[model samples]
Target chain A: MSDALPGSLVGPVEIVGAGLIGTSIALACRRAGLEVLLTDSSDDHLRTASGLGAGRATTPDDRPQLVVVAVPPDHLGAQIARALAGGAVVTDVGSVKVGPLAAVAGVPGVERYVGGHPMAGSERSGPLAASSALFDGRPWAVTPHPGSTPEAVALVEALALLCGAVPVRLTPDEHDLAVARTSHLPHLLAALAAGALADAPADHLALSGQGVRDVTRVAAGDPALYGQIVAANAHAVGALLTGVRERLDAVIEALAGGDRAGVEAVLSEGVSGTRAIPGKHGGPTRPTGTVFVAVPDHPGELARLFADAGASEVNIEDVRIDHDPGRPVGLVELTVDEDRAEHLLTSLESKGWVTHR
Target chain B: MSDALPGSLVGPVEIVGAGLIGTSIALACRRAGLEVLLTDSSDDHLRTASGLGAGRATTPDDRPQLVVVAVPPDHLGAQIARALAGGAVVTDVGSVKVGPLAAVAGVPGVERYVGGHPMAGSERSGPLAASSALFDGRPWAVTPHPGSTPEAVALVEALALLCGAVPVRLTPDEHDLAVARTSHLPHLLAALAAGALADAPADHLALSGQGVRDVTRVAAGDPALYGQIVAANAHAVGALLTGVRERLDAVIEALAGGDRAGVEAVLSEGVSGTRAIPGKHGGPTRPTGTVFVAVPDHPGELARLFADAGASEVNIEDVRIDHDPGRPVGLVELTVDEDRAEHLLTSLESKGWVTHR
Candidate 1:
């Protein structure tokens, strides 16, 4: 009962599923001081999500102010229709908006339903991994059909705002193409990279680096959901793959002939052009702020080593410990203040701490 | 000049072609208190390198103990042959070792030649960009053929040591495959990603994000240089591309009609498989430290802003600036000592610093 957040701000949200996305939406809504009702086909998932404090389960006597339909693209229209018929201002969260919108458009009083998708997620799946802050400061698209009411659109926008998401306006086709380039294409590329190494000897793969990990990060996404998503939007994805294939073909041709100039030109183009792409939250993706350190082994040594950092009031945003068991040392990635990094290293070394430059 | 780095090291060296690699090698050699005779086809290039204290120009009278052939891949074999004819122990710093090694293998008295490719570089080209620290702590692969003199191999490794670079022995084929997977394929991928926007209007391209920029960063490399490298390693690169294409096809198919379980399984495989990849210095890459700061557009802001971090007594390692020109504020990426970051940010904010969740 934080009065600072109004009734409109504190949602009466009913999530129709308790899978990853559904649980995440519930978690986020609850965090914002909302009353969330979560229902799902799987009672086990509901229990898990509930244990995570996503929201308290509710009965039908509580009329939801907004209903978010989080289900498979195939089953999405039905869920939205059910929410609307159940007398709730409804929205559906699905990858492809057009198909579901088209299917449900003929439904009487379709304006009660608005289409939305939060374009931020992780490879982690299931209700067990639902995050209350998953929707924080990310893009959320709302697709409203011609018959959609202004109140419906406004309500959807309010949900996005409350969830700390940026609202983007686009036609169904525009949204499709944009995601095809950004979201869907990256997933395809990552999957392709991952699939190539599926059968590789484990030892060879251990030698892989950040580049491959980065290129294939998205490949870890849920294939079934992705399949259902891509099928609904095959034309856009197919077109993108065709472009990738053409470029790859040109690269192959240049390599076959040992044409140094041709190969370099293509590579150069990629470097220059990619710079223009914005980073998350519409920021330039600038590279900075990482110091890789190699350290020596000793059970109590790491704890003591970090003590100095603790004394200094530094915060490590991320850490990676890569140590071969037999080796007497390890490599640690310490994300720290760039300006103070040189001084920290100097101080650490002065304290008899070993470091990899 | 500083005395020798207290390590048992070798002497007067000759470096051919004072480009980025050659000049950088010269600088490293000179830093180790070894006299180096640097040669290049362009006197201007040689002078620039010499100005950077890389090395002095060589005279015919200089019979160097070690000779480094830092020419283009296509020109390396001929150059190594000439250097060997001069009775100098030689090595070529070319991206493709097998091709050049084959081209010069039968040259008279070829035992003195060792083939090398330093697996580290930047997109920028030219001798002016050379730095002694360029190869420090990076991998430098040395491929000594059967006929290579043991002394030559040792000398090449000694050079790598002087540059503070680790010496990795890769068979020509292993080396080819590694570069193709880690370096070449990434370039192609990045290029294709970047080039996709080539057809996009400039304004639309301006909205590119971090993911796209990251995937495309390597695309800005020199086209001519890449062409030579790719042409030389056609088979390896071609195989990698084919692998990429197959994987991509699978992803597309899965996304089109696959279920959530299927897609998530595929994505999970990628994360687990890729997390095993080693980082640049042979460790896994991790998220660097991070600090979220609310920065406003004000005069003398950055300096005063970071001054608050002084309380934590930790130096910054890297900095990222994210600003929206239209907005009055921005977010700064401050990477610092991991342990100190939390206390520092807290102290900074307590001093009236602007920050947000």
Candidate 2:
């Protein structure tokens, strides 16, 4: 184990895949003035990534100080094992950590391998969809196995930093369980909710509102890719699903028995759960107020509304646009600091914008 | 039955409740130069609604031409029944239609009663949260029962139009089932998904991303209110929950058995379900491209970005702000017409904004 301190990682950082995540990491490394060696099974992807200034093609003579495996989940273990044989510190950007870590356990250089998963991605894939800022300010879990050296962990953290992400350290098992609750569980729920709509009558679907749109939004993601991701984290996901099924059964029973209190209990739990989520900036949730403004459905309306909002000097925390059918206007909900909501409402109203709380 | 036309609705429009929907309806009617008579069980709500110019206090001798019942679900049936005794064309803005319709089925003036649901509301309740524009450009389901007269239906449809909404006609049963699928089902699913996170450790919650946030957003609604909602449509909601449970079982079974193909099939159905949702303007879904821009987490940054985006003359269909913990920046995703994405990209890039698709 090389006991490298944070920011002590030197080039060349070899990326084993030239897909979206791999190429994006390579671009970020290049931006940090590091030598990135890129390779891929597909010649076209490698050529395109290198041509885009992500990195140069890897040569047989090149010796890498760090190797990042960014291939599909099935290929992760094999790639990590291959990278480990080169005597370089290895890490992977796979979604699940436990399975892959277990795959490479007892390998000759297992001590030099740390697990990482950057919590950022888009529905689009391939090298063309890569961006240097893909992981900017996102959470990147650095999962270290018991046998992993601190130096290997530090290097993985440094790599996350290089990609403009905040590194959160957790054990490989902990990482799996955490993501299972946050990512896999939510995805499955979304898919299940959305699947019910597949054969729905047009009248039922026509009644769809922003709520359904939001719940089903992520369900539109590529299935095959998510299947592998979920299958990799099955143990943790299965446990959570079992818990969810129990709750579902409770809700069903409550509904059937006309048990309002039972239904409300479940709903109250949901409210608390929503509040449990940390607000932006990773702090306790803050109180916010929403200001609704009706804007005409046109190009410059938002710019105008936002400019007016900016003039109020109230920081906008979030924005949601609700567009209804057969309407020439769209409602824009602006979430702001609770104390400033009234001020924003008054400011926009005074500026001739129709506003509501 | 008078056989009235769409524009034949004339006031005095008497509102049975002075809650959010009732007060908003009063305000909308007032905006259209109608004489509104407001009443509420609570003196404070009545005073507030009347003081806000929503309407005048209801008088004993007033013979209203139309009555809108907007009380809580528990009181909706009684209110609608009482209003029908006044020989007025009655409508209730309750979420579930069948229950209220059934409650007034054999009333003397039942033929004059038409069920209505504005399909618009806020998490915030009471008269203070009311707005004249609440129903503007939104869907208003005009659900008529078997014995409903055309005159009553036309009057209700006119009321929807007067409030700046497009009236979507559905049978009372159809309305209930439709909302059960679109609104209630989604809410329950959101709650179920969010409930799993209630007892999650801080570390697990820290891994939360936009997907989980979006899926769980609606779960934060008032428990008692949602309980009433989900309970009112219990039959339909319960049926959907049963269907959802079957899919859940399939997912759990697939995960346990390591059936990749089974998992992929469920996810694929979700994709198709998401695609079936109509786009804005109540048309088939349109292909839209998302342009992501990094904005500083401060006042005026969004304003500046929107200004630059507006300059490109690309009509933004939607906007989402993703804020990460410990980040001084937020990612703004602007959705626009797919064909014009490149134009907007180049235009924004020329203005020194860092953007990605």
Score chain B of candidate 1 by TM-score: 0.84
Runs off by more than 4 Å, candidate 2: A1-7, B1-7
Report, for every candidate in turn, its global Cα lDDT versus the true structure: 0.67, 0.90
TM-score of 2: 0.98
- Model 1 agreement with the true structure over A226-344: per-residue lDDT tens digits: 76676677778778878778777777777777656666767766665665565433655544343345455433344455565545555443344433222345445554555655565
Q: lDDT by residue for model 2 over B26-138, one digit each (tens)?
A: 99999999899998989999999999999988888998989999999999889998988888889999999999888878889899899999878886789999999898788
For candidate 2, give the lDDT of residue A62.
Answer: 84
| Worst window of 10 by summed lDDT in candidate 1 chain B | B1-10
Model 1, span B149-208: residue lDDT tens: 777788788888787767777666777777776666666776777666655543343323
Kindly report the docking quality category of candidate 1: incorrect
Candidate 2 residue A312 C-alpha distance from true site, Å: 0.5
DockQ of 2: 0.81
Distance from true location, Cα of B58 in model 2, Å: 1.0
Second chain TM-score, each model: 0.84, 0.97
